[model samples]
Target: MLKDLSPQAFFMGLLTAFVGFASSFAVVLQGLKGVGASDAQAASGLMALSISMGLCAIVLSFSTRLPVSIAWSTPGAALLVSAGAAVGGFNAAVGAFIVCAILIVIAGLFKPLGRAVAAIPAPLANAMLAGVLVGLCYAPVKAVSFNPAFGLPIVLAWLVVGAWKRLYAVPAALIAFAGVLAFGVDIPEGAFASWAQSLGPTVLLVKPEFHLASIVSIGLPLFIVTMASQNIPGIAVLKVNQYEPNPGPLFATTGLFSLFSAPFGGHAVNLAAITAAMCAGEDAHPDPARRYWAAVIAGIGYVVFGLLAGAVTGFVALAPPVLIQAVAGLALVGAFSGSAFAALKEPETREAAAVTFIVTASGVTFAGISGAFWGLLAGGLAMGLARVARR
Candidate 1:
């Protein structure tokens, strides 16, 4: 096992954790807030997610012997931004999250439900994930335009390191981004000290309130997106890399963890898409069998990061939100490119995939449901029509 501990895999794992968290962690916070979580609840949510997903990653990786990295459902969080507000308030949102979690657990345990989700055409799944990421990929460009002095240099660092060592590009960009935050950003007085005072993990329970409207309007849609957009694609990502692990427990694990964390401000935890590639891809380890360690180390990194999340949240408050988004975009370019390729690769599903891509990327929401769900809806309709015409 120790022989597998190469610097390449270790650093790549670290990079995976850093990029994964930095990318859209702000969205997690925003979604929690939109759902009506108090500032304290939001901090608690972040901490719980880091710990929950961390343990999940460690458990799945060791048990399956595959590089299975779990993540908060970013798209699910995106749903919360609009749905949380629409459905009522934060407590209502917590109720919706609980319902969604129960549904995810059900989907995982039932063989027919798992098969149905797995049956989502590969092209459409890839396209939906690509669409979700493409919008995020633009953050660095926006960052540069918004703050060239900082963003431009980070881009240069990423490009240079990417050219030199492809695996390290995102990590280098992250390091540069962190340096800028460390030295350049104006952190408010006593932010660190105040955060330090509350260094220990705190779980804030929002006793879930069940409402029928919320269950249909918020919970069902949230489950669909998490399963379709995050978990399904996450499995696809690992499969394409030639790592096939049982999906049942993987889904069940994340669902249960999401359920556990919902009261504490965490939104949803599912299989990771972009960052999973970082740990499972060739860059993580030349020998695919050894790549699981990358994920295990990533779990460790998450645990440490979660412990320090209180301080990080304080700094996040002190900094410009856009910059954080920009850094996240930089981290995700590789994943974006990979998903795009997979989405466009097959001719049979090409048109349907394009529909999925466009609808998801458009960020259109309806009836408190996100574009991801609609993207699948639109793409599925188009795909079904195409199949009928062919038949």
Candidate 2:
């Protein structure tokens, strides 16, 4: 099956899968902790994410014949960890998931809000995206501080590949991984060995209880963040690539998936920007008809990894923290730059976008929600009010 694919298509798919796998490791760990999951449960959550996103990617790819890679909702995952830690534990988190699903279904059904989000000015939407990505860059930079030995090599790999203009199209991450191996970095002896030891998995089938508090705290916030931060920009990415998937179904499907998987500790699911970009690019498949296989491969990878959640967690834990951080930051550089440029491009929107960028990057939380959502809301409102006054 792989042999018929062009070299670019094959490599793009491979790169998308690798990035999708690595990017979610830390956030998954946080999700497990939110629900007070044991080591095994925590690992299972990671596996669940891998499986859900992987399967989604595969189905969407093959069906659409586009390089549409699905990924665990990064914002949703981060929110889950943060909110789940604060609220009534896993039960509350589950409540949030249900609420998010309801909201998504409504959005799909309503038509107006879905269209509004899709219709947001491209510059403004991109500005909001840049604001959202501000913090993501820190992960890799911080990773360097945590484990310089491992982190340094990864950074060097990015630099080397970046400097070598000839290999510009080669995945910087693949190069980074090779650099890490070349450095002869010591892998913990027990890291690989632990795969053989099975901790009798305890699966908690959470019966989601509806609580007003949980709904307000988790559900409402998750819906907002997922929509504002993840889904909106996701649609933008698709549009940017000229794929133009129907936003209603796409949003509805992701929400439905999250609703079903929340009890199993799966965070939000949405379209993947960076990974999707890999397959959507001209380099991936010029013909466009063949690019979808990359996503199919990704979805298959997710399901396989999710079943082995324990092993996935162990593997992540075993890797040097710096390495994880470095890889994350490097991977997000393009996103960060894109966001910043978007935020500053328009003379009229600059101030509001700047405010959004600052507030979001500050990482402040109020009323049980993170700064990203609030930042965008506040900035957008400010811009709106200013326009009204001038008019």
Error at 379, model 1, angstroms:
2.1
Quote each prediction's TM-score. Answer: 0.80, 0.77
Model 2, position 200, has a per-residue lDDT of: 32
lDDT of 2 by residue, 1-391 (tens): 4653676776677666766775556555654565456566566556666777777777666666667778776655554444435356666666667777778767776898676655655445555455555555666667567666666666776677777741242246545644674454576667556755743332456656666666665666566656766677677777787777877777777767776677766656777776777777777777766777767766776676566666556555555555554555565566568657866889888877877767666666676565656666777887898799889
Error of 1 at 343 (Å): 3.0
RMSD of 2: 4.5
Query: Best lDDT goes to which candidate?
Result: 1
What candidate 1 gets wrong by more than 4 Å, as runs, is: 1-27, 30-39, 60-69, 74-86, 190-192, 210-222, 228-244, 272-297
Looking at candidate 2, what is the lDDT of residue 40? Answer: 61
- Model 1: per-residue Cα lDDT over 205-302, one tens digit each: 77777766666656766777688878988999999999777888889989999898888767789999878999999999889999999998889888
